[model samples]
Target: MPFFLRTMMKVLRVPKRTIFIVVIAFVLGSASIAYAIEPTTFHTWFNALYWVMTTMATVGYGDYFAKTVRGKIFTLFIYVFGIGLLSLVIGKIIDLLSTVYKHWEAGKLNFHGKDHIILINWSKKAQYAIEEILSFSPSSHIVVIDESDKHPVTDRQEIHFISGDPSSEEILEKAMLKQAKAVIIFADTRIDEPALADGKTLLIASSIERLHPAIHTTVEITQEKNTKNFRHVHVNDFVLSYDAVSRLAVRAALQQGSSEIINQLIRREVGDDIYEIPVRPEWKTYKDAFQGALEYGATLLSDRGDLGINRKLNDPIPEDARLFVVSDEQTYRRLLAI
Candidate 1:
């Protein structure tokens, strides 16, 4: 057996009850044999050994008896031993049952799906992001991977928590990296070396890309300078909190209802929204989709074809392109009807 198993067995092994039962069984068997051959010089110890094996194996032949006074005393002693042995056996069985139950519970929490969000670090911002994702899609499964023993998000049936260092390949594999929709690496702000934290996040992102090149990854960088180093990783999105916050503050002051508008726009699964949709062969230009959006009470934001590129809102659409449009489902359906 493995060392762990051996250790556990020693720690949780059955009690003295088992020994008592064995002794009792031996005594009873011996007594019975002694009684069967009454007046014969049959040794009690020899008869006990024979009887114990037979009884434990459930091979009673009914050829033995404990009719005499000495034999009866031996049988009484056997009963005591048997009871203790049974208790010990029962205790061991209970321990095994508990262990199996725990394993079953853990299995039920396994995550498997695409487009599902994987949050790397456990922090206030990450916690908020989780809440936002949940609010957008209540049925969406969010897996939190962190080294902390305790998770920040409250226990829920849908959320899966795996405690481990995010940078570890084993941990990432456990979180189902290849199958994940988007892996979001949150920089560990609690650490003194914020740049080192970002580096770790970058390494994790790069590892995922190398393992599964097609996988979409988004990373948060605490320092703006770190963003330049991450360019080689091909991360789909790079969110800089410092810059985004500063811009948001400026926009909120200049544009009335801009903060609320921005909040609704960024919030997933709510309000008049912009979402990516593949352009069909029939749709030739941005103008073609722009007209469709107008009819659907929506606006075409950008095209997936323009991803990783610097393009203006009014940029002409590529012939073979995918588009991002802002609209409600009713409007979306109507536009599709065109």
Candidate 2:
């Protein structure tokens, strides 16, 4: 290659924005030159542009051609330089896509979306949580943070992963924790002792609370006794893994098929899952909310943490009431619409 051509090729490898602008300018300038030099043959700007593009791309459709000697020489100039520039652009695009994919697989990319759910630590339980979240809301964005080198789930577009220590504030920020809708810190099952696992979870929970106090946070702990420790950090909810399984097993043994019913309610893949509904102006008491939900083919389950809404059917609804109902997806949508 000539010195000028080599220098031009080097310039093409600059930042993407600059290369993009240069490509645009080159296409426009080449088209204008062709149109000015061969007005009789290249009748319009579009024709000249088409010819220049085809020549650069090496497509050479042969629909348009330069009739004059000067136009032919100019076309040759474009054939040599323009084709090289176009090749560089194509190569650059491929390189960029490869770089992005590597970053994604390595969990080195940062998530900037708001209202996304963040799951710290990757485990079988976290995998199930991702599935449930997707089933509940297919379009929901989820971010996974862990110390592992590779992302656990790369097939899902909605689930993003970041590789880092969960307790580190810097890693949490990379996951965009402050803008997240909720953060679920799962216990590191690799650790054998319950106290050690809960200790790790508590550290991560405290970091999240300090970074974004208002954001809802749910944590899984091995021991139920450590639940009180989370209260100091104002963690929103706790999932007692070991105790919950044991209690559910005992309940199932006492009442046949009771565990199955609970499973259906908790998992979105099954029937009549729990859902939250907005408080309407018409609702004055638990009776009003219950009847309204029933009319929409749903049953009001509870108000906030109070599961005894059945006992307080006649009592006035509190102003800060958050009503939960049991319904399928269609019924839930109808209730939300109202």
Candidate 3:
């Protein structure tokens, strides 16, 4: 039993070695056993190998036959021992594949996805975020990595997983970090301490930035205090979950239906969503942009760019200026053209 367990472990751990051993054993065992009957049944080593392969595979072609009494006795042992060993080796391969699959599902395997979205850190938030993205684009490739023992999301073959610290370059590389369309790093909300959780998220964002400086990244910050710290990483966007919730809670306590209204605004099923578009040719001037927003039924939120924000709307909109507008998907697209 102990020897069997050790062999199983070796086969599972080092399948290449097990395959080499099995192939070598099959050649030597078949050559020794079948060569004895070669003089009667098979004329040469090549014919002996053909007979052994066919017989062991249980495809008994009648082209070869044992003529002598000694050959017949040896044939009995060949059928029993050769077929049994070959079956055991084939069974080992199947078992190894199953074991590898389980490991892969558990996120022990390296990632191979490209042009996919990567979600760093596992949490209820991560799961929801992934689901939200997939709801709109179900075919979008997504890879999730976390330090947790087991993946929170499963039964999703489309969602590849890497179970490890996201800050590790080795682990990040497995997810095809450089080739990813975008990465969203969520604070590990499982950790009781909010600071520690946000800190980890910050580190993961910085690590991703270092891995590929131009890779677009979005990170969820759980602590209001750490908001400024993430700016150093040059993250493209921040979720600011803790601060947003706290402000919403304060508004709800002071006013009527504030929380419900805020929730409705951000909810996926809500009437409208926030979208951003670059300033258009007709909307080059601030007054034109402002009038265009009103004409198109889009609520103009802000005019911004990578290096600066122009909330005043008094000056002319620059060529690189982007406008944040709140409107339905259909209206938003029309507003961009108008």
Candidate 4:
């Protein structure tokens, strides 16, 4: 059975008293005819039941008749009482059906499983972030939790959306927080109070941490100063939108193609881009990955352990590190000559 139907059945299950009343009414109404008519006429219980059904349905055929005066009176009671009971049953069924349908609609957007990203708050930037994540991992499942009535993205099976306050434990539980890989809280664009948005975000992060300490968390902040307050929450990453934009503007002023390069790096498309590959212990140094990248139409950017190559890179490939060019699997295989 469908979940909605099962729930409705549980809710609308007839009470013992109601069942007893209905049974009594049906039996009394049917037996009332016995007071006026002879039992010998119907010949069997099956025939009497058939007569009762036809009479209650108002589909009387002249084949069966109640000739006695008492039978006429019993027929009158059946006509009035039978119609009312039938209507009540129909109304209850309709009510149960409507309840089931509403639950079914809600169930469609419920999330499940672990290692999924949960995005709190809906905004243009959040939408862009989701698009970027999808571009890299096309099969990744995203659960969006927001208070908005409609989701910005078109309904796809891979994307689950729930409308509720992110700070609420009930809502977070519905988003499958325990199994989530990461939670990203977007700064609410409508709210002018940066503190309020950050508070909510922090509360959600704290709740997740309390429930599942190992889950990764990232939060977007409008003010750079508020970033310090979130340190205790053990947030994996924090994005100061205003500061980042200002820095980007400064860079764009000096470099003409800076913004384009950043865009291409974020979006997965045909381009030479930076990507992270897990280090294989057999590959002793970054130089091995560099030689591997030369064959694969890619460059070994840097090694995860090389602290010296953190941000400053004068050349495309860094020295003494292991970073592989990440493109399609075919390109990676061909480059490795595998």
Candidate 5:
């Protein structure tokens, strides 16, 4: 090796002894050899590097050639060794990408971002929840935790998957539960018994509470009677999945089109869905806020989960108030701007 080539390799940090480093050293050394032997044919340093690149890439443009016997021998050596080393590097890169993609699809990677919604368990209800969340906030990041071998939803970029036992703290940490906006746990319907499914959900919810007590967690249970069991855990909310369906069915039969109305309210894509809005600076009382929303074509529903805002119209609005309203997306946008 030339003194300058050795010095250049040292400056380039080629002493790491990695395959990539070795490949870089080989290419640079080959370029220097080509330039030193045939300075007339390869007039510039860039031409020597370009010739090495074309030969290693198998492009063989044939613009540069070896005129001497020694140059031809060196060219034959490159054809045998240089091309093989470049091919090895290319194959390694392809393999690395394939492994990363496989790990991602298999839910083996960790989510490093914050404020993402963490979903526990995969089911039809979870699928609908993801759809509804996306309808409301299309840019929302969702991290799904399930015990499946592969990701349930692969087509969407906003949704990520982590495969493991939901009750495992390691798995929750992998999903970045500490920085999550909220967590939704669905009953694993694959289990034969409803009690077993609820038990799984409860265990996962308890784990979440232990890991992050302040993280708002909503759980779905198959049986309404089992709600008492979760009283110990500080779960934010619970949904009786089967009981809700049965109640909705009875309501639909009793008060025609009631289920449709409820469905429309729950779904963001449907007309007049529920939305939360911040209090405007000019609003002083419930009446002021209510009338302001009415002017913007929105109906005031409640303030901070208090549904009796209609009766409390004369009362002053609380300082830490969160108002809920019913309006279309366009009307909500207009209300937000005001």
Candidate 6:
């Protein structure tokens, strides 16, 4: 064994896998330059590089070739050593890629983006949430973090995955919690009991709040009873999964088209979706707010934040009012601009 190769093997402890890559790169590069020196149809360095790539991919176009005896001899040399070595290098590189993909799907990789939403659990609901986010805010980045050994999203793009307990500071920091826009913690539906699932969800919410109380956290509680416990944390929104669904089902049973109406109100994929925008300064009362909403072609539904939703049209709008309008994303943005 060469001294450097032996030393590298001892130091890196990966055998010839790493050494072959470096050695093949150096050898192939040097050989191509030496063979392309004179009139061998390769006039420029770029042409020489093109020949090497085409030859490696087994796509010899014959646009460049060996004309002289010396160059022909070098071509023979290339077939024997160059092609074989290139094949080995390619195989090893592909193996490395497959290994990386496996790790990524297994939730072994850590997230590295900023201002992204972090999802704490993986379920069918998580998949739906991902699809909805992609539909509504296509530009937003999402990182799905789960403690389970299985990865939820491997084939998906524009979304990242991290496998670790969300409550741990190491994992939270890995997900870039300090730079996160929001953390959506989902209940463990596999737990079979709402309280048990909500308990675990609350624990994660508390851990996140403790790390950065300023972080906007939306938690899914399995049971309505768990809402009181979430008050301990600075959770910005709560999804009463079971309770809300059940109530919706009841309403749907009582009123015709109630389920479809409710679905349309919050649906993101098609039709008008619910949007929240700041009530501009000119909108001092509900009447003005309605007029402002009409100008933007959005129906004013409710007010959020330091304001009540079910108010008369003549009622005064609160200073810290956020209006929820029923319209497309463009209309909502237009209303905000007003």
Q: Give the best candidate by lDDT.
A: 2
List clash counts for every candidate, in order: 9, 0, 0, 4, 0, 0
What TM-score, over all chains together, does every model reach? 0.65, 0.88, 0.69, 0.62, 0.89, 0.79
Q: lDDT by residue for model 5 over 245-282, one digit each (tens)?
A: 89899999999999998999987887789889999988
Candidate 3 weakest lDDT stretch, 10 residues: 304-313
Q: For candidate 4, report its TM-score.
A: 0.62
Q: Which residue pairs in model 6 clash with each other?
A: none
- Give the runs in model 4 whose Cα sits over 4 Å from its true position: 1-110, 149-154, 270-272, 304-307, 310-338
Model 5 scores a TM of 0.89
lDDT by residue for model 3 (129-216), tens: 8877886578999999988767566788888888888999999998999889999988786788888988888888889999998888
Clashing pairs in 1: 17-84, 17-85, 18-85, 20-81, 21-81, 21-82, 24-78, 30-48, 115-181
- Tell me which residue pairs clash in candidate 4: 114-179, 286-321, 286-322, 296-335
> Could you tell me how far off, in angstroms, the CA of residue 211 lies in candidate 5 after the best superposition?
1.6
Q: Which residues of candidate 1, in runs, are more than 4 Å off?
A: 1-115, 305-320, 333-338
Instruction: Name the candidate, 5 or 6, with the larger lDDT value.
Output: 5
Where is model 2 poorest over a 10-residue stretch in terms of lDDT?
8-17
Which residue pairs collide in model 5, if any?
none
Backbone clash total, candidate 2: 0
Query: Model 2 compared with the native: what TM-score?
Result: 0.88
lDDT of 4 by residue, 1-338 (tens): 59989966764576645844785579555854553375776766666666777776678986675667776777787789776565656676677688754543454356667788998888898888788778778899998887876655655667777877887778888889988888898888878888887777778778877887888888888777777778887887889878888887888989988977776665666464566565455545455555556566665554554545424443344343456454654565565554
> Which candidate has the highest TM-score of all?
5
| Cα error of candidate 1 at position 269, Å | 5.7
